[model samples]
Target: MRISDSMRLDAIVRQQGHLKEQYANASRVAATGAKIGAPGDNPVGAAQSVRLQGALDRIDAFRESIKTPKGDLDQAEGALATAGDLFARAGEIALQGANGSLSATDRASLASEVDALKTQLVDAANTKGQAGYLFGGTSTATAAMDAAGNFLGNAADRTAEIAPGVSAITSVSGALAFSASGGRNVAADLDALRTALISNNPAAIAATVSTLDASRRQILAARTDAGLKSNRLDTADAAHQQTQLSLAAQRHAVSDADPTTAYSNLIALQGAVEQAISVARTSLSTMSINKFG
Candidate 1:
């Protein structure tokens, strides 16, 4: 079939233009390292990628919540440990004061040590973590205890979302957590011990030993609760991390480019474009100049 010269030249030019466009697109893809730059590149995959990103954001928020709870639990556990030690020491001092062989001077010396422990326990009760008070429950602006070891803070039960369907309390009420099972709090017991020590009365000091023991048990129980919360927080953190990882994988599957495949494809496309340009240039060069010039 005979073809018009102008039509033949136009066909070559169009082919060359198409090849050049492909080369430019491949160059861009390689430079950007993106197989799917926009929704139009892969509609279904892009939609899934967006969904996965949103899910990842939610998982991250959950993970943060779990982390904060764990921090609070850790601080509470530490404070309880200190409180337990203080109570145990108070019991020891009471026992020492109960000894008849000891004089008033000795009992006074024991009182000094107990006084220091009181301060120590008070400071421990004021421990703070990422969110604030460890034993205060929710009020973070002030310490959990007063100078006399009395519970002075409100432990408004605060909720932390560890996962989509799970939540954990991040703090314990200082008053409720520090009181004896059915008796006076640790501070009052220590005060009673101080009074008994002043008189150097074995019977009086001995009577307060039980109160101190009960106070110790309260602190230990609080520690146990904090431990359980810590464990749950760790589990929630791990689960949230897993969910985020899964979402990240989905995002990568949708948008990430395969380096090896993309590189090879780019090289092949560049070669094809170069060849098309060469042919088009040759055809244009051979075009007949029908008039004498």
Candidate 2:
């Protein structure tokens, strides 16, 4: 078979072009440190990476949502603890006021202390958190109680999305925590206790002990609920972190280039291009000699 000089030269040019393309692709992979720069590089792996990234993005959002609710629950638990202590002190005063040895003057002095405790308890009930009042349910823009011991907040519970298709309650209802909805009106019970002490009524003072106990229990139960919700947020965050790590690893496997392998391939392709150029130079020189000699 006879081959023309033009055909031989054309074949050499095509071979060099192909080698240059391979070298450019290797250079891009080395520079970017990515195995799949485009979907065409690895369609299956690219699709899998997209799904994993979507899952990671959702987990990130869930984690961010968990933060606000966690802060609110912590503040709620602290406020409830303070309320519990105030009730315990009020209980002590009730016990002392009920004693027969105590005079009216002594009971009056006790009543003054109870008044202070009532003010403190009200302040605790109106505690604010990251969003707003912790016990105000969904009505977080206002105080949960008024100075006159009336409940101003609603009974609706606030919630937060902790994971995909999963949510957790993040608020304690002020109406349930401090009003008769939970068995007794906590502030009203304090008011009654203070009134009994001021009037030096032993029987009335004695009657308040059980109601005070019930109010304390209600606050305790609310605190427990807040604690449980906080734990749920923590668990969800941990799961998100774990899933993120797993998804990131999977994404890396499908999309990232190994540094060692990429650099090695790039070096090999570079050498191949250089060798192709040298071969073309030698071949063209020989062809020119044959054609002109």
Candidate 3:
């Protein structure tokens, strides 16, 4: 029960050190405007913050993925629309050419237009999307056209993840679209039209027209499919955004400290530390007077 002078001094020093540490901690919190400076302060909150940040980054990446592909699919849809219109026009010309009442000069003039439409259709099929070829699938390093108007694109599958484990297929492979049901391509039909016009064969022109009609239908069907996928992507994106917002809210509630409350508590801590220092100094003075004065 007997306390030595050295023990008394040591106890006073330890108390002062503890008070100083509290003051320093409060000041740091005030300056940094954060209640959780280190993991030791709030281990659970710190861990949750880390997880929330990871989720936010992933959601941002998912958003970017869907955005870029959406634009590319829209472009593909536009190109298909234009190509279909041209094919319909070529069909009209084919019907006109079959009429014997038309003179050779009329056939020549109509053939020129048919050739121009063919070229235009080629340009449309070779359209590029945001990342690569719209109708060329995943590979888009080069133009997707050959001398015979055949598409030389790959058949790669691509999808976008909208949620933690849910992903939607937003893109169609070029091979699937061009090959259609029976491995037929829009360009193949256009080539037939080109041959029919250049050869001035009425029967050939008619056959090409039929094929072109089918090609147009095929393009339309593909476009419809792309549109549906786009819609689904948009829905998924919205849902993902909502989930991200919820995560952010949860993180803020669990980990983020209120500046106003933190500041008030810090001020109180500073006063308490100052009071403890004053009392410790008074005790030291009393000890000095009893021992020496």
Candidate 4:
């Protein structure tokens, strides 16, 4: 049971060092509000936190990725709405021009108005949005219609990923919206209306009314499809927000410190460290040069 002074001194030093380390760890946890400062502190929780953080990062990425598509769709909807109004106006002019009482001068004046409407419809069809041409399908780098109101884009719809394993179409098919492929060609119909009025052909002008009606329906249909896609994007966004919140909570639970507990532990560890220091100093003082001699 006889212990050497060197052994007693070594034991005291080791105990003091251990107490100091514990006190430092508690202090850091309290100050930073992090339960695990390093991977070694809580390996399982830290690993889980890393995974949850990755999930949150992916959610944020998806959120950013959908912005362009959303903007394009909104712009496309507005353009389609304008196109519809132009078609309605064209229909009204066509009905007026079909009257037999109107002379060539009046018909010519109406033709000029119809021509202007055709130009406006072309502009609406080739409208540019945040992500380039709103109706350009996959060919968003260029205009969706030519100067003569012909289709320049395809029927291919562009899409965007809004969430994991979920995607939604962001671009409408220009060909389907303003070309013959979509049941009626809006621009061509308007041009025909103009040509019929200029020629003073009652039958042709009357026929233009039905054609313009069909073209109007096509625009309405395209707008409806775009609206449905927008709704889907909204749903995806809502779901993403919920997932992000859940992931944030999960990561915080794994990595965040309990402030109350951390503070109490810091106080207790500080007291233990102070006591260890006091005992070590007292012990060293007792072992003076007189006692050793």
Score candidate 2 by TM-score against the native. 0.95
RMSD after CA superposition, every candidate: 2.9, 1.6, 3.1, 1.8
The backbone clash count of each candidate, in order, is 0, 0, 0, 0
Candidate 2 per-residue C-alpha lDDT over 174-220 given as tens digits, one digit per residue, 9 for 90 to 100? 77789888888999999999999988899999999999989999988
Candidate structures ordered by TM-score, highest first: 2, 4, 1, 3
List, residue by residue over 1-293, the lDDT tens digit for candidate 4.
98788988999989988988888899999999999999999999989989999889989999888777877787888889899999999999999999999999999999999888888888998899877888878888998898899888889878777787776777877788899999897888998998999899988999999989999989989988778777777778888999999999888889998899999999999888888889888888887554777
Model 3, TM vs. native? 0.82
Error of 4 at 170 (Å): 1.5
Candidate 3 lDDT tens digits, 1-293:
99777887899888878877887877777777666789999998889888998998888888878888788778877877887788788778888877767776777788888778878877876788777767666668766666556777777757767667887776755665565432567777766766666677777877777777787777777778778877877887897799889988887776667788778878888787788778878877777557774
lDDT of each: 0.80, 0.89, 0.76, 0.87
TM-score against native, each model: 0.85, 0.95, 0.82, 0.93
lDDT for 85 in candidate 4 is 92
Model 4 lDDT at residue 93? 93
The local distance difference test score of model 1 is: 0.80
